[model samples]
Target: MKIETQCLHEGYEPGNGEPRALPIYQSTTFTYDSTEHIGKLFDLAAEGHMYSRISNPTVDCVERKIAALEGGVGALLTSSGQAATLIAVLNICSAGDHIIASSSIYGGTFNLLDVTLRRYGIECSFIDPENGDAAIEALFRANTKLVFGETIANPAITVFDIERFAKLAHRNGVPLVVDNTFATPVLCRPFEFGADIVIHSTTKYMDGHAVQIGGVIVDSGNFCWTAERFPGLTEPDSSYHGVAYTRDFGRAAYITKARVQLMRDLGASPTAMGAFLLNLGLETLPLRMERHCANAERIAAYLSTHQKVEFVKYPKLPGNAYYERAMKYLPLGASGVIAFSIRGGRERAVRFMDALTLASNVVHVADIRTCVLHPASATHRQMTDAQLEAAGITPGLIRLSVGLEHIDDILADIAQALEQA
Candidate 1:
């Protein structure tokens, strides 16, 4: 099925008497008629739900929908965006393993890789996105298991060159893992450009109404797990009675291991309630994305013309460094996020955000309502001045998440706020 059809019909098929809408299977455990059948599930010899922590029917439906949308063999939903990132890496990496990641990602993700993961003996080297292919390839070591980056980085809004990153990763026999949270599948499908795995903070665009907090990891199923570097999947696992994930699961090796192993141990599975809400939000995603792009383009143009605006960093605008790349990867739209700097620095940036009436000042983005935030003050506050500059977050920069409101109204709100700034 095509993307539009898949969004509505791919995951769940209604039987003659079944509910048309995907129902929430809220039970924690599924009953089996025979102990032998239950044994097969626990041994990973069969495909069926044994426990909610390992898998849930309601969450499985949503995961299938997301996997279809992302052009992946399978997907796993997690309790939060952070959990998704952790699971995606942990599935393939272990202690003493290393990763090469772009520096222009979310503050939380940066902290995870730079600080938290380091404590677990998983090291990461941060590289600039503009470093080009040779520079990126230089970061990879013999123990580097994966290369990670974002499609459109949070706050920074720099569009990654997917093809370039993919080439570098594959050359080193590693898979490229991308955070598709900002771009979403509607704007760009990373798998088409050779991304082996795609991760998302469904809390943002997927749940456009801001009704749920969730995340997902979609396995493209194109990478080879038989490589000697990854023995975890190709080799036997004593925990699962000497089962090899790659030998049994085939294309689903990555996500299957993530679910039966990491999810079972860590228990970061999403609830049926969150999955239901996310599916509801997915229904209108295509339509909402169109309005969001239109509104953001208008607002970016408005801000670019304002005297108080020092600079605008939206890819849709002409002369922007990422305009051509955005046109190639996200031709339909370059997302609803826009980053701009105010002429009066941080003080005026705060005033401008506070002056907005219709666009609320919030710590959220990619919602149905227009919202604005100063990354230097709010999201990226943990970074020092040098760290902020390195991430392209200036002291006066403001991040605007344009919503599905009328473009004129959104622009008017920004114009009024700029006047006050």
Candidate 2:
């Protein structure tokens, strides 16, 4: 099926007598015929729902759809984007392992890797991804188990070099994990560019209405997990009755381990209601993304010529640094995100944001309604000036998430706000 058709028809195709829409299986547990049946599920010898904590029918449908969208073997949904990142990393990396990640990423994820994950004994190196391949390789060590980057980084709007990073990770005997929240599969499928794993904050474009907060991790099932390299997947798991993941699950080892091990232990599974809402968003994703990219292009063009705007960063804009790379990977469009700096710095940025009429001021992005945020003051407030610079977040930078509204109205709102500033 085409992507648009897959959005609506991939995961759950109701039978002749079944409900048309995906039903919400809201129960916490499922029934079985006998003790032997339930025991087989517990022993990992059978396939069926056992508990909502590990899996649920409602959430599974969403997961399967996302997996199909990204061309992956399987997907696992989590409570939030943060939970998704945590489990994706811990599934492979242990306490003594290391990770090489691009410095340009969401602030919440930055904190997770730089501060929180470090305390757990996993060391991380933040590199400038624009640097040449040799420079990136310099940061890798023998114990480095994975590499990470965002498709289109938050706040900065820098487009990542997925193929470059993927090759670097593969050469070092690791898999490349990309956060594809900004440029969803409609714009770019990272798997085609060699990304081994794809992740998303489903709270963003996948849940465009902002009605749900969830995340998902999709494994491409292309990377090799050999016994000599990844003992965790290839060797026996004494915790689960000595069952080896790679031996039993084949290409699905990563996702299976992530579900039964991390999710079962952390209990970060999405709520049934949340999954239902997310599925609704996914159904309209292709339509919404078309408008999002179109509006973003027009808005970026308007901001580029604005007197009060100091700079604008949108990959679709011709003069932007990532324009060429974006054309290669995001030919359809680069989603709705745009970042610009106000002329008067942070104070003026704040003034302009407060004066907006049609646009909103919120701590969120990728919503159905246009909204703006100041990274220095809100999302990246916890980072120091040096850290902020490393992440490509300037004090005057204003991250604008353009919506499906008419381009004229959106520009008028920005124009009036600029006059107020």
Candidate 3:
């Protein structure tokens, strides 16, 4: 089936008397017939849910749906987008291990890598995505376990060159992990371009209604953990009774490890109710994405010609740096988010945001209602001046998350805001 069809029908199949809609299996634990059967689950000798922290029926259905949507072998849903990033790295990386990440990413993720994870003895090297191959490769050391970047960076809206990053990572015997939150699977599937693992904050576009907070990590199942570089997977796992993940699980070594080991300990599993809402959102992702792209393209065009606008950064627009890459990766449409600078800097930018009557000034993005945010003041305030500059968030830059509203109304609101600026 095509992607559109998969979005609606791939995950769950109901029998004769079963309900058509995915039901919420909200219980924290599942029952078993015998003590021996339960023992097998705890030993990892068999696959059956014993606790919600590890897995749930409703959440599994959504995970399967997303796995199909992104063309991955398996996926694991987490409590939030941040949790997915943390587990994705921790599954392979240990306290002494390191990661190479693009500087252009969500501010929250930056803090997590730079501060919180560092405290745990996991160090991260931040590099500019625009820095050519040599600079990126230089950051990789023997301790480097993963290469991390976003498919389409949040707030910055710059597109990462996946193929180049993937090649660099593969050469160094590390898997490329991409945050595919902004450019949902409908826009770009990173696995097609050699990405080993794809992660998403389903709280954004996948939920679409801004109702739930959830994240997911999808394994392409292409990275070989038995490769000489990764001794962790090939070696016996003492926690799992000397079972070597690669030997037992084969292609699903990464995700299986994340579930049985990381999720078991960290306990960042999503609620079954949240997964049910996410499933409903996924059903309409293809249609909503088409409208989002169309609306974003129209708004970007209008901003480009506006008198108060200094520049607009959207891959769909011609003359943008990422247009070619976007064409290759996101041929369908770039995404809903767009970044632009208002002519007069910080004060004018704030005024423009305040002047808007139709678009909301909200903390979220990728929702049915159009929303705007000033990263320097709102989201990226935790970062210092240098950090803000590195993330491509200027004092005057404003991020507009285009919604599915009528094109004329959206354009009119933006036009008025520009006039006020």
**Top candidate (lDDT):** 2
RMSD in angstroms between candidate 1 and the native structure over all alpha carbons: 0.9
lDDT (0-100) at residue 136 of candidate 2? 90
Worst 10 residues of 2 by lDDT: 223-232
Off by over 4 Å in 3: 226-229
TM-score for each model: 0.98, 0.99, 0.98
Ten contiguous residues minimizing lDDT sum, candidate 1: 1-10
Backbone clashes counted, model 2: 0
Per-residue lDDT of 1-421 in model 2, one digit per residue for the tens? Answer: 9999999998898999999999999999999999999988877889999999999999999999999999999999999999999999999998989998889899999999999999999999999888988889899888889999999999889999999889889988899999999999999999999999999999999999988899999999999997876899999998789889999999999999999988988899999999999999999999999999999999999999999889999999998999999999999999999999999889999999999999999999999899999999998999999989988888889999999899999999999999988
Report the C-alpha lDDT of model 3 over 132-181, residue by residue, as the tens digit.
88888889998899999999998888899999999999999899999999
Model 3, CA-based lDDT: 0.92
Q: Judge candidate 2 at residue 102 and give its lDDT.
A: 86
Off by over 4 Å in 2: none
What is candidate 1's TM-score against the reference?
Answer: 0.98
- The residue pairs that clash in candidate 1, if any, are none
Best-to-worst ranking by lDDT: 2, 3, 1
Q: lDDT winner between 1 and 3, please give it.
A: 3
